[model samples]
Target: MTATAAAPEEDGTAPAGGGTASGQDASRPVRQIVPPEDLHATELAFLAAHDSGPRPPGWRLTPRSVVTFVMGSHGAALTLPDDARAAAGTPRRLVIDGKFVGDRALVERCVVTLAGERALLLVGEPGTAKSMLSELLAAAVCGTSGLVVQGTAGTTEDQLKYGWNYAQLLAGGPSPAALVPSPVLTAMSRGAIGRVEEVTRCLPEVQDALVSLLSERRIAVPELAGGPDGLAHATPGFNLIATANLRDRGVSEMSAALKRRFNFETVGAIGDLDAETALVRRQARAALERSGAAFQVDDAVLEALVTAFRDLREGRSAEGWEVERPSTVMSTAEAVAVAGALGLAAAYFPGDRDVLELLPGHLLGVVRKDDPADAARLRGYWDGPVRRRAEEGAATWRALWDLRTVLEG
Candidate 1:
């Protein structure tokens, strides 16, 4: 996903979608945020019940079942064969919940890559949910998504390998107890999933550390050469999932050697307007509910908001008219932020205020980040598209166009 918001929104908390995808358990007093591993345990258990298929070493699910788990059952119940059910010694109702929404073919390829225990790279624009997809894949393939290293400018090679525990190092010198394995090292030793978020953000040198770890499937520890803990070899079922922002590709480009070891897949924006709108609303409402705020935002306002974002995002109106896009990324994640902000204002501020009017200012805020000239780009968008829509008898556009001075100011 390209950077969704140019910068993090003030209230950028992701809506809690955990173990319960159908609906929150009413028996729960408060909302709980669980990791993908914990969240999908029940569904995984169900799938495993019916899956008598051969699996790769150390894998929890077969590649076919892994895809089914992530893509969901498409409103159909996944019934097991009578023989398989008998083998499981339990009733099977594997409702493969649809979690991630994108190309099914691409998802299958991702599942295949992990099944092969090869590194997989998820590349896309910000807010494209690459991170989420990685989590889901990791959890599904190995049954754990907690082993992770967040890549950044400050990220070090030690974060990908091992660091010394100061206390143990001081007392016992170089030993296994003094060694603190990074998430990557731990994953290699235990044969679990290890994730690296925003790989391009790491320094080139630090990023290169992956080349050997991935190629050899192990890490050498000269400090323990004569002892029992000389090296950590990757067990079967160990793999790495790294996500990199497409927009940041050139910043710290991965070495060709590192790139060659992994399969690459790019995730794109949601193509269907209604699908995208429904997702925005669903996530927004979840965010509202998590905050214990009543969702009072109107549907039309939401439709208009998503429409405006879609328009600004692609530099064109829904009617196929041209509109200039700002330099900033207008990701769906940003739309969620705007919607969340509007909903909060409606619940707390409590007025007969036109929620739509606040849109221009919020949009202005989204565009006026990163680049100084993006402000001018936003103005041009208003003058071109907003002006045409207003003149074409769109009352909401006319109202928004009336706030032209807001941008000028």
Candidate 2:
């Protein structure tokens, strides 16, 4: 049965009644990071309570509510009726939180596509939150986002379809009980979203496994055809959400046949600097707090770091100043990581070691990858953007420009 989460108390946090995936163990002093599906269980229930719109088969919320869950509620409120509240002996109101920040039109299109049969494919440059968006969509569509396949060169067809439990196979032969369902198969049978991450990282042959499953909406278990197990046909709501890095596109490009089965959506980096900076600080503080550390990374340092990354990522300033783009992706994810590291450094190793001194080195680490020429490209960044910005009399730029030697190391 789908669990109904308790409405939030006067504060935003949910009441204790609804059991969520985020419930901590009383026996162990450990932090458990919950997925979107679990973390927003109550919120989803609340949305469902107020939704009167039509939904696709097997969907938990109306398409409108799904979009609201992602883009956030723009002052939409759902208050329990007086009679219902009195009857239930509880008072509650549902106010949804906007989770993902991006183009509303894009999110609306994605929701519309997922409501139908065509699989959704999100392609983007690194750090674009393509995967995060996919997860949120999956969680909101169904109630679980655990059915996922991480695509890699070594990922086999068995991982996408079905595998044999060796012990059961040996003891009982290739029977129904011996067959282990892959995430894709599990999603197919249960009518849930199955995710394929880094789809291009897998070899052409292995990646092709999805083509048949998606087109036919089924997977045949040939070995058990004569017995109990045969074809696993998809249920009404079965769908796929695949993500590929733009950098990895041509590596093992999906065949045109495979691409045709998907609705392609591109997830790009945050367009606004303030939004990106807030995301960085929010993610960094959350990460730091999880590690039992106070986040003391200065706002000035974060702004400087995000500004540098934005410049390097776009190869141009917000003012349209030209800069040399790095060969590697300087994604917002990398920026969040750098921010987290800087915060931890401040909390643990408090001293005269200036946080600004570490920015150039961390950026160097982000850019210095694969191609040897990337380091040169980063050095060129310091000379061009850093030099120009410092000349404009910005103290942060002046400090980073002064530390040009750090990039060299």
Candidate 3:
């Protein structure tokens, strides 16, 4: 079957309906956050046709293409050959934009792990895009990114393994028809990728359920034992991609046995200043676009915003001056959010206040999240870096230095 072909139901039949479960109007308002699969469907289909190389079983694209899909084509346009161009809904020429702005090698490692059918664990700081990478990888590998379990303190083993429809069970008495498969179980049966976000947040016992599933690659349905639907075996491409935040390390630590079942990759913040600034701009602009407003934040203001975040994040200035790091993470994701707020402020309240004037307040808000003392740390940052930069006569830093009172309040 082609990459775009609709997947069959667990019972090996095409889905009955052509409409949504609610039968909501198709022309009604769309979702705020579209899934990666639907958002980049065309790119996936194009890449599938673009590369006819050997793919791992049950995979939509070759492993190499999966990496390219995540890291992008690096500004080079990929032209679909004449034969492949005729495939419906795919553009003849397209430049795949980079989604995750981290190391290419890290993405490659993730793809390789999935290709090998081993569970992949992405551990990172709270806002380092681990979930985004998981979603993108799942979307690229299996043509769908919807198979996911959001880990939480309330999470249960049933969420990772299986549950049952109580009414259906009462009617059918433990039949396969009564089963409600978890996202992981469904992925096992269909050879798709399943994601578990913030796995560390789940209770330790609830999290341990994955140990047997990852090792054995099958889920046993004891209720249906000796029947045709007794056990659900994993299809060839079945794999799991889980994300955990570094900040949540001790919340529900994984057992050594459970940890051994997966390949762990640590995703870190973007290292390059220019790349981070560009990403902040791109993400902020996307946010503004979603809100139906133009992105009017200036480049100099964005650079200054990013610079302050980096200085605080790294605990040192670009000029090698010491900075007292705050207890809270000054992540790039937070930077993007602040930039988006600035854009909105500029678009909605033009000339009400300079956008640059709003930066310190936003930074103060971010810094004060974990501890109030961090506000003092932020003030110290201003008294140090802001003071030095202003003394150096850079106009943007001088403007920020003049607004130290914003942080004071």
lDDT of each: 0.81, 0.82, 0.87
- Candidate with the larger lDDT of 2 and 3: 3
RMSD of each: 7.1, 4.1, 7.3
Name every residue pair that clashes in candidate 3: none
Over 131-191, each residue of candidate 1 has an lDDT whose tens digit, in order, gives: 9999998888888888999998999999999999999899989988899999999988888
Cα lDDT for residue 30, model 3? 56
lDDT of 3 at 174: 95
Tell me which residue pairs clash in candidate 2.
72-98
Residue 271 lDDT in candidate 1: 80
Task: Provide the lowest-lDDT 10-residue window in model 2.
Answer: 82-91
lDDT of 2 by residue, 29-102 (tens): 44446677766666667666556678899998889988988877655555644443122323356556666768
lDDT of 1: 0.81
Stretches > 4 Å off in candidate 2: 1-32, 74-91
Using TM-score as the measure, the top candidate is 3
Which regions of candidate 3 deviate over 4 angstroms?
Answer: 1-28, 82-86
In model 3, what is the error at residue 373, expressed in angstroms? 0.3
lDDT for model 3 comes to 0.87
Tens-digit lDDT string for candidate 3 (26-118): 455555566777667667877899888899999999999999889988877777776774457455666676888999999999999998957
Q: Please give the TM-score that candidate 1 achieves against the real structure.
A: 0.88
